[model samples]
Target: MIEEIDSMKNLQNEVGRNARLVGRILDRLREKGKLNEGVPLENGGLIKIELNHIANETVKEHFLEIANDNRILAVALNLFHEEQKKENPMPVILVSKDVIMRVKADTLGISSQDYLSDKIKNYDALYTGFITVFVHPSTIDSFYTEKHLPKSQVPELKETIDIYPNQFVIFKDSFGSNKSAVARYNKYTDSFEHLYSPESVWDVSPRNVQQRMAMDLLVNDSIPIVTLTGKSGTGKSLLALAWELSKVLDEKVYNKLLIARPIVPMGNDIGYLPGDKEEKLKPWMKPIYDNFEYIFRNRKTDTNIEDVIAGIKNIEIEALTYIRGRSIPKQFIIIDEAQNLTRHEIKTTISRVGESSKIVLLGDPEQIDNPYLDATSNGLTQVVEKFKESKLSGHVTLIKGERSKVAELAAKLL
Candidate 1:
């Protein structure tokens, strides 16, 4: 136990070091005027970023091009567009490399792009874990019938497998393998029944095992709490919302669907953000609003957003702050940007869940907004890492962005 604690301490130190390096890179960008039009204050005071006066004309034009392409630009660009629209009719664009930024931008018809042209490798792929192997057609019997291959030669299984009488062998296969990849094996349904999806539960189709798991937890009345973690552009929030809507609107399983996300910023300070709390939260929650609008939009008729938002007390859009000291019952709750929350905050949020309630916390740890916590320390990661062994909990790391090929390639290459 002592050695394990020490190992965790060392890992924490290493993660902190990397986070500091990331902070330094962002600071350098701010100094070089690459981030936004704002200048950092000495005492964490008000920031003064010029909206129209960017240093490079080429970069500005590039931003304009991105805006023209129907991508939602950065927050600064969005603010600039709103401020300058009346004075000067310049196109608005958002510049960013973050996958969530592009996703949000495309949803809102704002232009956006990565400041850097080339894409970096997926960080998760670089981190080592249990290897997966795929077996060949005829090798199934050999793997189960014979002794399992030596632990060193065989790829380690990440999760427990249940074997039953006359189960099929499901082998793991990789890029390079002999006659077959790792051997295959199957389990019996007698021990634990694997749930299948209903044909018409608000277009709830699994398409894969992970999504199947998500759907199972969502549709089942027994499970009240579900948490999903993945990289940006994943269907974590989308799936949660879709499932919640299915329950509340389509099936009438729940009384209401309430969605809320944190209002944390990426960098610097929000001290100079003009206006009240609602105004401050508007920028952070724009993505949520955009999603709501997209889902509520009508193809045939011209319906405005206010009417859609007012359609039912059944669906509520709220901030995480307002959730404290409240008992939410008979409602499907989704906490987007949950990675920004602390352990205490998550606890508070979870405690508010009353009878006949389901809370789904969805966010990307890699794209965390909270500065004090890293990927491992944040509430979302802690929940996922700790609760993975629990039968009631499940998670999926989405690899594909079904948005567009450019967005997909950008996520991979740039």
Candidate 2:
């Protein structure tokens, strides 16, 4: 009887041990599987891990293959992209610092989380070197006329302030009409232009100061290369077109004008599209035509369409492929939609600018159509970043999208 009782006790003890082990496993799963409260993971089931943000092609492909394996359930990512659904079909998630990647992931039905729980640095403040300041309305004029502020008064400025000549200053007075100004360092005048007054041609325009700087660089004719960057509707293409028109027709700065933009589509391969090069380029070049139509609006009355066409012929419009082996001289060149171009492609385009030829590259760094490049690393952004501080190089960021109210709202919201 005692022997039988011992066997029964052993069985009960084993059962309890098994139950405890199962409970521990469940706890681990719950900890790993559940998304943190208020975290913006689209699907909720994801574990954030620290990983490299930028990976090479082979590494990316290998990771995708690993993600597809059914046996693996949890993914630890330094960066999570909802749009990386092409290779990872499973319920995968990402953890990344990149806001665009999170947005892309959410759109692609993937889960995401931030890698760091600590406070993140304010990116805008870091990049622009801006400091928010409050000033008495009476002293607003004084501040503009005199660039110098009292050293004692500088203490009243907010902490973590960034100081850059290109930085903007915001005056938040008690009054409702607060004014904003950009700090413009004038190499010509050997002083700072408050950007509120008409001290220089460069400082008169507050909205497109960066673009104005770019135009100035082109106009100086000291540099053969110039690049302009802004978001869509921020006057990149229009400014380029305007500069070309002014230099070519009005000032007689150059004998000819040339223009081109890449033929790339969103989320698809160009090989699938039917038709010849011109047909493929027509859709992508629609924005270019829109600018031309607007510019030639009044000129269309006396000059016919054929005349304009002939004029454009003198100002060549050819694909980037055809630009190779061509030597262009005495030309004002503008390459619109240049965000799609690779570093190699940009190098090729810039090299083709012959003696006395000026080249203007304009595009939205954020709206890059190229798969390999992003906002920071793309050719357009790269060029601007590399050349911004140089005397011969300048850049302008057009903040107010002057296209329309609806367009502005759409850019902000959607």
Candidate 3:
């Protein structure tokens, strides 16, 4: 805690925005100190602040080999907990967001836990928009012929499984004769409708059933909010951009296509990067730009990339840091790398959507770059689980990597 406090005073050590926040806190400490005399304490609370209660030499020497700030704090905290145990029988648990630190605390016999207030669910149990259901061959036949199957058709299944609107469903034959059908649940009609999306978008076909299901959610105008979570090469961004380009350019359903990704919040050293915000962001946004080039090239647009972007003046790509307080209407917005966003930032970004706007959160929960966010606590998973029951939103987790043989192997093997 002491080392962290010292580091926060230096702009070079602290994050760009946290310096001012720490300064205000320091100022408040000084003001409160003047009123309270020698020691500063809260007005009325069981909790007490221990200032300069540094750990002893034994604990310090034990952590000297690691020489990291976090390890040092862990040593100090462990010592404090040990000392407190002598006076009281209360449990001293170490609450932190760092996984490694939690492990270290456990090694030292300290009770540690990840901060759970922002966590929506565990990564393994996260809501995937698609589910497979084994049913009678007669039900699959009826679905294929009638093109829709009422939820009542599977009354016994509902008692065991919960259904949500816009959820992708795959009905398989119970007898296992390879008879199957793919459908999407319609909460309004309470029926399973056949997948009705273009076979391909921007000349890119849905490579697998998950991709096909994702496409169904992407192009649905009725579903205003969508989320796609997957590893690299899963085509989350490609599918999102495909829909944005097709909708904004071909369909003209939305006035603009906006893509915003976190730059400074991704724990990258953007301060030392050359040029302005846009230039600094280019390297980070190169993946999105690459998808654009691939889509335009495959679509047979002879125009240059610059000219293409110039012609489609409705499309915008920039950093998420600049999206605050902006009301976007009739726009298709994609929040890329959304796994790096905090819960507060997610709420802020999603709330910026205006009437007629469709927002899609896209990223891999397993590949988060934010220091304080993990798969379960990140904005992507938060939205996926929280909005699963909402009719206006849908989500799909793409498992297959369609980028290339080598890329797919690396995404899995590495």
- Every model's TM-score: 0.54, 0.55, 0.83
Model 2, 261-375: lDDT tens per residue? Answer: 7766777665655789666666666677777666666562676443465556556666665687778888989888788776657777888888888888887767877775666
lDDT digits (tens) for residues 17-66 of candidate 3: 45657556656777655422343447652322344444445545445654
- Output the lDDT of residue 6, model 1: 36
Candidate 1 Cα misplacement greater than 4 A, ranges: 1-192, 198-209, 268-280, 297-299
Best by TM-score: 3
Clashes of each: 24, 5, 0
Model 2 misplacement above 4 A: 1-189, 192-218, 269-280, 302-307
Poorly placed runs, candidate 3 (over 4 Å): 1-46, 51-58, 64-88, 264-273, 299-303
Full candidate order by lDDT, most accurate first? 3, 1, 2
lDDT for 262 (candidate 1): 74
How many angstroms is residue 299 displaced in model 1 relative to the true structure, after the best TM-score fit? 4.7
Using alpha carbons, what is the TM-score of model 2?
0.55
Which candidate wins on lDDT? 3
Models ranked on TM-score? 3, 2, 1
